[model samples]
Target chain A: MTDQALGKPEADRPAKGPLIYRQAVLTRITHWVWAIALFFMLLSGLQIWNAHPALYVGQQSGFEFDNAILRIGAENTPEGPRGFTTVFGQKFDTTGVLGMSELRGTTNFVGFPGWATIPSFRDLATGRVVHFFFAWILVGALGIWAISSLLNGHLWRDVILKPRDFRELPRDIWDHARLKFHHGRSYSPLQKFAYFGVFFVLFPLIILTGLAMSPTMDAGWPWLIDLFGGRQTARTIHFLVMVLLVLFFVIHIAMVLLAGPINELRSMITGYYRTSPGTDASLPLEGRERGRGRSGGRREIPTPDSSPQGGGEQAGANRQEKSK
Target chain B: MSGLILNRRRLIGLGAASAGSLVLAGCDQFDFLGQRNDPVRDFLERANSLTYAAQRALVGQQALAREFSESEIRQGQRPNGSTDPRQNVAEYRTLEANGFAGYKLRITGLVETPKEYSLAELQNMPSRTQITRHDCVEGWSCIAKWTGVPLGRLLDEAKVKPGAKFIVYHCYDVMGGGLSKPEPYYESSDLIDAYHPQTIAAYGLNGGALPVENGAPIRIRIERALGYKQPKYVHTIEVADGFSQYGLGQGGYWEDHGYDWYGGI
Candidate 1:
């Protein structure tokens, strides 16, 4: 039944012509779950950060050591109350958003504004609760996704960069900068790089650093703290990783919009991506090629066959046949 | 796809169970669900408890908080929260006037022998001096050398009763005053932390008598926990089986207002 539904020829479905199985059912489901989990994690994390708006290096930081790398707070100036963010001894006035913000005419001294936090208030307990809850979810989802993707070859075929990707990096960046995205089944080099960085490096670092900051975790794995150069340094790295993730989100959204949000959203939601008719001919058997070349960059591009039908089935067949 | 769905369902179920357990445990005042009573908050409260339990289990009863070297001792430890007791408190003022000569630390509750020790007596006792870092929940840390009697020694001397599960510190500072009823700042710790080698009733800081602003005559240092767990200006140490009747029954003043009682991190 699954095969019949997904394996139908493109000729029989002209209305949604030249559809590519860009996202598998598992991929689509995991994608949405990740979206929800990350949303909660980000907001709640901000809420937790508000409790102590300073980031530092080394194991210990306080009035004694000049180890503070970043600090957000409000101070009384000669003019008036001002919110400031200090990084490496340089202070920047960030009033009304960070360090200090006003809600209903009452000024509040906080790290991030209430609007950006999970509970939208200065409740440290609640903030921690929310942050930790989503943290579990995020970790679980990532673990499952990683295992499944590894087994299915999705990690290497789609996310991990190949030698060819390095060669295509310049072109992919230029194309993306110009908003000239190629509507293909395989990820662009830039997309592969971004996703790979987030999935492999940033997320893992965040999780490990987070654990390092926990006192209990320190007891369980003292090496974790030592690896990060201390709990405070781990915290600083965690905050930086969060900043990188936020940047990834912005770029991801922008790319989705530029490349066509309706198509991108539909692909992720329904597992069917409507490929550009012009690019379809040039990028024929792209999915099948990915399936065959598990090591990536080793397959030759086949000429476009007249029949667009059974591309999805052909890709699956190629995966099985190659393995055999 | 079905497996993914199952995973999500399992996650949601786990979240729900966590929330449900907190509600069932009847720690409503401490749980987010009892305060705001929302599904999200409920889930978060459960998660916090899971963290608390998991960390406790992993670290075990004897794990020590990281200690630093004397070179790591930064400037004098910064004073935060309520540093000074209210001037109107007569006994506190008198104690301050006589250089804490009249000050006495009383140990009562769940003990075979209740004992009161003066500053001089506490000082004369075998002392452990270590340079340790104080990590505040607000995201800052300070290192200072502290000299005091180990709490375990004091507890042994006082002969803690077997049923005692928690050590509650009654402090002299009164906070949240002005328009409302003033409440004394108090905190408590489990026996595991109370008995830790680093846990001390410190009377000296940075080679000098502890400054009044830095908990003055005495403060409790449970090195592994956050700064708030180290209650300053301690007037009495009470060993109790439970803290159900203390400060809205959540264990500490901050705990009553939503902070976790087991603030090990």
Candidate 2:
């Protein structure tokens, strides 16, 4: 087949059909699940990471007034009982009456709002419960995605870098530097590389670093700490990975805005997509279309130009696409 | 909008723009994780003992945790470790029923006088109160008012042996004796932490007699270490130079299960 034969034609495209089949129900569900997991992990982790309460620890430098106040309150309330004893002995005439005036004073109260305080979330027992549960969900879903993707051949087919991708990578880099993709097609090769880096490397790093910090998990899998350096080092890496996750999330949203928001959003939620038909049709079928074009295999991603097929096939295809 | 469709060209541009921020964030660790070992880790471990030596030169052992107002105290301050006293429950219950008239703390191991004192006798001695933050290894912390006698005074009264460098608290919550892993529930601290001004044999919390859940008659209030170090329902005191034979040789029950022995952080 000539290159032009496989290439999408300019004008013979269908007026409307499916744009692209980049996402499905499984992808949508997993993405949202991953997003929420990242959300709680960031917030709860920040609460513990709070070395300086005045400004975010992620920021440069700030006065640590809360630490000072806590120190003073700790000193006088429980340690400085001489004053309490003297007052109690002279005024109350009873040793039973305890003094605790310093603890209640407003000077000691730290200033985040009540909503930010989330009492249930602050409890150690509660925090542990939530962390463990969400951690399991995040791990379980990722495990399924990884295993199924490998079994379905999507891992090698879509994500893994092929010889052609490697050869084209430098041109992608130069093009990216020159901002040559200003009116580019779907995704520039460099953009694809960034997406692949996040999905394959950074996300896994966050998960592994988190597991390394868990004492029970570390005991069972001591090599995890060795892999990261030590417990403290693991904690530092886990925190930094979270910062990366946040950065990626921000960039991803910005990218969606820069691209066609409706098209991107629809592609993620529903499997069907309407593309500039003629030029792209033959390209999507290099492997799968060979002996199975009767079911309109590539054309089968969306609802037919005629009638709806089994919802089961559509659902199964959605899951298969996500595993990709 | 088709206009937002960056094609391949615009997408590459956006990707290059983001790479700079990623590089900056990645390179940040070099400052915090420098070359040599952190001196802060060692300094914190030696805080209790070194602070005492420094105090001797200037303040002469006067540093203490402050006492608090009665009204500001927590109504039912939650207990951290070993809340309900087991093993000696019947005996302790009998003592509590009789207002602890016969109950006495035995100070015997490696001591000159080998003294035994009733609760009333302990109350006769000088008392100290301190409101200090009880930092837990699991990342929660709370400030509580503790009233008790300074541990140094008690050790002085008992006349600790020359070889004793650490105070091992043998609690009433017994871990079965054997080479086979015994169920661990008690904890101990070094003599430096033992003699700390904040370290006390606490008899009261929030101005009242220590509640049963809060260790009732007495418990070690080692403020510097994690909450688990504060052993409740303390039965006997043993002073030892080494912990090689002590409870699986891990210092504490939880320490045997991978918790840090010096949980100073």
Evaluated with DockQ, which candidate comes out highest?
A: 1
Off by over 4 Å in 1: A1-26, A62-65, A74-79, A107-109, A275-324, B1-39
CAPRI category for model 1: acceptable
Give me the runs in candidate 2 sitting further than 4 Å from their true place. A1-18, A51-125, A170-188, A276-279, A282-324, B1-265
| Model 1: per-residue Cα lDDT over A101-134, one tens digit each | 9755788998888667766667777766666777
Candidate 2 chain A least-lDDT 10 residues = A65-74
Error of 2 at B158 (Å): 29
The count of residue-pair clashes in candidate 2 stands at: 41
TM-score of chain B of each: 0.84, 0.69
Considering only the true interface residues, what is the Cα RMSD of candidate 2 after superposition?
19.0
For candidate 1, give the lDDT of residue A194: 94
Per-residue lDDT tens digits for candidate 2, residues A1-324, read 121243424125433222344443555567667765665445444434432122111111112212211111012345333222222124331111222222222222222211222121223322232344456567767777677545533344455555666788899878756644332213445565666777788878877876554433443455665788644455556656776878888978776665555556545545333343232322233234222435334443443332132223333333444455
Pick by lDDT: which candidate is best?
1
- Candidate 2 DockQ category? incorrect
C-alpha TM-scores of all predictions: 0.80, 0.43
lDDT of each: 0.76, 0.53
